[model samples]
Target: MTKQQVNKVVLAYSGGLDTSAIVPWLKENYNCEVVAFVADVGQGADELAGVEEKAIASGASSCYVVDLKAQLVNDVIVPTLKTGALYEGQYLLGTAVARPVIAAAQVEIARKVGADALAHGCTGKGNDQVRFEAAFAALAPDLQVIAPWREWHLTSRPQLLAYLEERGIPCSASITKIYSRDANLWHISTEGGELEDPWNAPSSQVWCWTTEPEQAPDTAEHLSLSFHQGEWVGLNGEAIDPVSAIDTLNQIAGAHGVGRLDMVENRLVGMKSRGCYETPAGAVLYAALQGLESLVLDRSSQDYRIRLGHEFAQLLYDGRWFTPLREVMQVAAEKLAEPLTGEVVLKLYKGQITLTQKQSPNSLYSSAFATFDEDDVYHQHHAEGFIRLYSLASRIRALQQASATDPQSGGTS
Candidate 1:
């Protein structure tokens, strides 16, 4: 579809610098009514405040800010957690997982408002563009996608800022805000600035969600977590809502410097990028859940579950959340989590969370089979027959070798 065909467009607005610029550009370039759609996926109140006013000031006909926190936690975060989905074995996939939900919400808003096209501020170089476009294709294939960054001449931030300034569009963004951050209930990620250089260590200022390991208090904090069918249910036996529970743990764990990851990850666009992430609560939760899995899952089941987790992680990282493969893998993960109801005690100190104890109703460990002391349940002498049978092939090999060396002696003697 050509630009002239679009009469109405729905933009995934974030009230950020790029998105704030996109609103006016869409109106000027397309000469169409621009509707802004924002998904409140737990980015926090500070970012959400006056967002509608900002959208309107930038030339949007109307704005729709949907509360997606509960759905995000239940439908995306919880299921991903059950699969142990961590991108590159370190990232909890906080940013990658949130994009599909945001894009899906944009499509929903488009349908409601009778929009003809969908637009987003995601850059052509990033993974998010692929993620959002993929979802748009799956959900609303008929809608025209207007990715301005890919089509526009405004290549640099300075140019984009100048464009907005010339139009008298009020924006709060400045060049001084060096780092690009994405924050949610699960984690906070920092990119750009000094983080662009892999050799440069992340300065203390780069971290907003976690304390510095050096500054963390020496005293350790112990916490208990309860799970029901792989979903976190309680903290210290007190039931709490999913978003609140994650927030509570983030505060508790962040104070102790429990989660900080620095890695140069391979991007889906075929390039490597350096990023720093702080997933305080997710780190603690993953550790606790793994401990619980150890207590309940059998050896073979555990092995297969881990393999499934790796694949699920890749699928999530690649932005295939809406595909059948993701659903199938999630179903398998849920099956593994069926008996994973339990409680785990974790000790947090200086960026480390160690499992102290774990208990589950489906536990396979038995003292009778594991004890060093004498017990009637497991006869000590039974091991002799077991070992002989286990080594029968080796014993036969040895006898065959001896006979080969003395065939004539065997016949005469």
Candidate 2:
């Protein structure tokens, strides 16, 4: 294979070991100018501090730190929450949901800086590589995409550290680092180390964001959430934006040990991987939304949304966010969520969120019709006719089977 001409390449920078080495490596291999692009999706100040200086020291010509927290919560997280997408029935997809926003931002920076190529630190074996490339293809197909992990000879953290050291570049990473973690406003995911083996129980060190369930507060806490058309509009009757809502909920729920999950999931790349996740805010929000949904959506409509949610989860996990099908599903979800205005009170304790009370103006639940005692609104005697009509096909089939078994009736064998 021949090397293509790349004058300037915009690399997604995280100031991590892999990306720090990548800056110099991209310059050395492609002989191109490297620009670091960082997307601030509320990963915290620790990760962002001195990132620009780090990138320049590692051989990047300049750095662009774009604050994408608002876009991430409103455009990506809220729309996803409306669909009720949970990957493999547990993972809240915190990491998967943030990839497209980052990729799109990286592309925007590349175009703004007049860069001809785009690069990412994603490895070939992981899903992020596919996610970043898919968004790049959809948004800027003309830009050259480069992935150093697939081309580079270095394979381990020690090697990456050495590569940076050899180039006189400073990196803070060490071989003793145990877990690979990704965090944002919604949730945090931990993988690698002992999580590589399915039989090994996660040690206390594997968890950093949420308290262990056994160590959680003894008393339960009640949270009142208000929603309008499926989006969380208020917290305890006070209106709030998406970012503040999640940040506030995350703190409240984390202390109660509301969201913690350990599972082995099948990756889109055809491999099973074990990961531990802490989605405190997401857990509470999902429970609150479902409770509200039960009150507002009718039986058939709710069932249809459940099926749609499964499909939406798969589409999101497979990096199809930029496709037409994703948009169609999102629109369908928004339509189903139009009447989801309601209030839900949830109890949080010991890694669980229980919906205690819920009410909606558009609710289908009727106390007058549902009461077990005698009620004027519902006629119990009418159910006999409805039962017969509903079971007509079954009744006909039973009769046919009985006749076929009875010789006296002259039925066919």
State the lDDT at 22 in candidate 2: 94
* Candidate 1: tens digits of C-alpha lDDT, residues 1-413: 87888899999998988888899888888989999998998889999999999999999999999998888888899998899877877888989878878888899899999999999988888898888898998899999999988988987778878988999988888756689899887888999999888778888889998999778999999999999999899999899798888888999999999888998999999999888988998999889889988888999999998899889988888888889999899999999999889999999998889999899998887787789888877888889999999999999999888777785857322
Provide the global lDDT of candidate 1 against the true structure. Answer: 0.89
Off by over 4 Å in 1: 374-377, 381-413
Candidate 1, run of 10 with poorest lDDT: 404-413
**Minimal lDDT window, size 10, model 2:** 1-10
Residues 34-139, model 2: lDDT tens digits: 9999889889999999999999999999999999999898888899999989888888898998998999999989989999999999999889999899999999
- Per-model CA lDDT versus the true structure: 0.89, 0.90
> Which regions of candidate 2 are displaced past 4 Å?
1-4, 374-377
Clashing pairs in 2: none
How well does candidate 1 score on lDDT at residue 88? 76
Clashing pairs in 1: none
